[model samples]
Target: MTQDPQTSSDASGAPASSRRGLSRHLVDIAPLKASPAFARLWIGGAISGVGAFMTTVAVGLQIYEITESTFAVGLVGGIALVPMIAAGLWGGVLADVFDRRKVVIASSLASWASILALVVLAFWEQHLQGLGTHAPVWPFYLVTTVNAITSTVSNATRGSVVGRILPADMLSRATALNGISFGAMVTVGPALAGVLAASIGLPWTFAIDAVLFTAGFLGIWMLPSLPRLGERVEAGWPVLKEGLTFLRRSPNIRMSFIVDAIAMTFGRPYALFPALGALVVGGGALTVGALTAAGAIGTMLTSLFSGRIAHVHRHGIAISRAIQVFGAFAVLFGVFTWVGMHSGHAAGEGWGGTDFSTLALMALAMAGMGASDELSAIFRQTMIIQAAPDEMRGRLQGVFIVVVTGGPRLGDMYAGALAAVTALWFPPLLGGFVIIALIVILTRAQRAWREYDATSPTP
Candidate 1:
């Protein structure tokens, strides 16, 4: 039998006598040992992801501080939607046309520059406050929107490069490892943002993100050049149309996006964290950070012990089931928030005054959401990476990014708008049910999607 490249090498990159031992339940780390380049990319991306998420939390907090309104906080995502969509589409085409390494490097630089801009604006805001003047909020929105665009390009290109670097058998394992990257990003990042913002200020918080971004730069810089594999599509509406055309004909891929859209649109409750912390759950910035990190904790744990799942071939059913569980957790989160609000807990002091019991319950619910969501994401990503042709992978990943990023923004709007009219708890309660109902309907309508097998991906 032909020796697989993965098991052919030991940690020293020498020939090995036998395959490395693997735990049945722990995450498979063979992919890392097999490819040094991927390991670097993964580590760099994880570290940078931490910083990026920090900036995310800071920006949201900064907006909330300026406006003191949940809708305004949610508007941050709403404002970036169109530009981000354009960036995903354009970036996808760029990835398909240019050297993917160069595309990622350029986009990463732009994203880092945007973070620096945030640092500058943050300092400017501090200076203004000293003079009894308020800095304009538009700058924050503008900078974050630009960051969103650049990051989308960088991310889509990076995602596309994964399949190129690793063999098909390893894609699922790599995707699971990505969950760890995401976990680090969200779990450590937001929590640190809260501490830093509370202890130092927003300027320094933004500055730290700027500093940490360099690690990601190094990772992308070291990658081998990856150019188009076949006839490169022109970077324009035509290329986009081609991608859309592909999607229209591919039911499995289409259903994956659809199911994820349903989950993110209704089940996402992130936009409400600021308000929930301030008025409902009453822990302030600390509460917000904890709430955000809780989901990542669940994600990290799920990824940690994903060994058995890597062997599973029934991806479509796994995705559907995972998302349904996510919806249930979202509903539980709402329930906890409702109970906390009725319990008459006053807004606590910054980080120290949180209602620990109530916060714990809510965090548990959020963690459940994170675990289920990550499971579904793992399968969805694996299907895309394995099923799509190499030439079309970039474009397909672009559409995937749109759904991944856009769905949450729409959810932000939904949560924000609904909360604006009703109580803070109503949106998630209703949205959760909506998510469950829609997933059931959508899953039933597409039998092919439900029966999609990982071994024979049909995108």
Candidate 2:
């Protein structure tokens, strides 16, 4: 006979009432030892990501060495934004429509080819065409542009694979794990690149990236075959239109992109680091590099204990809060910079002069920026991966890549323009406040997103 309802507490004692259900939901998550495939992918990605980071730092140094123009340095992302978008979006549709594995493999190969080409160019040019000695801008632009496009495709396809390989329940864990891998790369990659560039040569940097390509191939090759979605649709505007249509109806995905855009547009201030390091703060190029790497360190620290993050269900809430916190950190960074700059004016006590305390404070701000950004990024990727279907995950992820990659490019312009017109520290401080305001403004307008449940399907 069934026990009397009155005798037991909390809704018939079904062992799955809201409170207990919530507890069980949290109890389940993947252990690192479970999936060797995931483990292998994570390891390979970590390795390749470091290589990518090396290439990133190398490119910046090379460009600066060649042109000695901040504007040219900004152009790296600015010029590539369009093709990256085109390739990323189209690549996403292809991922959903074709075999995601093949798409990733092909893109990886293309990226590898570009890196190898750079190595070759460096070899011949250093001796014959005078690469490092003379600095011809054309080849620099050509190889980098091609590399950016291929990398976008590779990025989108890899995201699709994450959704496919991991079950829905484990997406957050996988995403968190990926963050750790990415963090490792970011932390190690640039430093290694800087060391290698200074010691061996830029050509060797490119060569290193070429070697890393094989690891990515191993990651992809080990994956099981993934067939395209059964549905056949036209490739061009219609497929793109489909992605847009989904976003239009999906308040969560839509809001995530919109808020992130707002944050980037207003809060992003990386472009100012070099300027501050030189004219405003006083450390020089090495200091700028330190501030850049500090963010990666924050990300690495967050990933070290991502266990608690998996239990949070109100992810939208998490996103909004993390971003708000991020904005605050950015604002504080600017404030510290401004105060330090003025404080060290004539007597040389602060950042602009000979103030050691000033340098430490700036480093702290940069570290805070890194921490806030890492948390936001973890939530951001989770929303994208779990919300979209496998078929369209690639395209959606592609759009995400474009958003992230493009956001800073716009920030570069914003920072450059504002700094030229105003004071040195104005951009980050002013932009940080704007980010806070815009996030409030944007999120208040989207109630549907706030109510979105990750467990449900998109209508």
Best by lDDT: 1
Residue by residue across 190-242, what tens digits does model 2's lDDT show? 76775676568778987998898788789877978887766666567788888
| Residue pairs with clashing backbones, model 2 | 92-395, 344-350
lDDT (Cα, tens digit) per residue for candidate 1, span 1-459 = 546745575333444444344545678788898788899999999999999999888888888888888998888889999999988888888888889999999999999899999999999988988998778899998998999899989889999999999888888889999999899899999999988988898899999998899898898999998989987556778877888898899999988999998889898888898888888767677888898999999999999888767558889999999999999998998898888888877777575667778889999999999999999999999999888988778888888898899899989989999999998888888988888898888888888987888767897
Cα lDDT computed for each candidate against the true fold: 0.87, 0.72
**Candidate 1 pairs with clashing backbones:** none
Weakest lDDT window of 10 consecutive positions for candidate 1: 10-19
The runs of at least 3 residues in candidate 1 whose Cα sits more than 4 Å from the true structure, single-residue gaps closed, are: 1-22
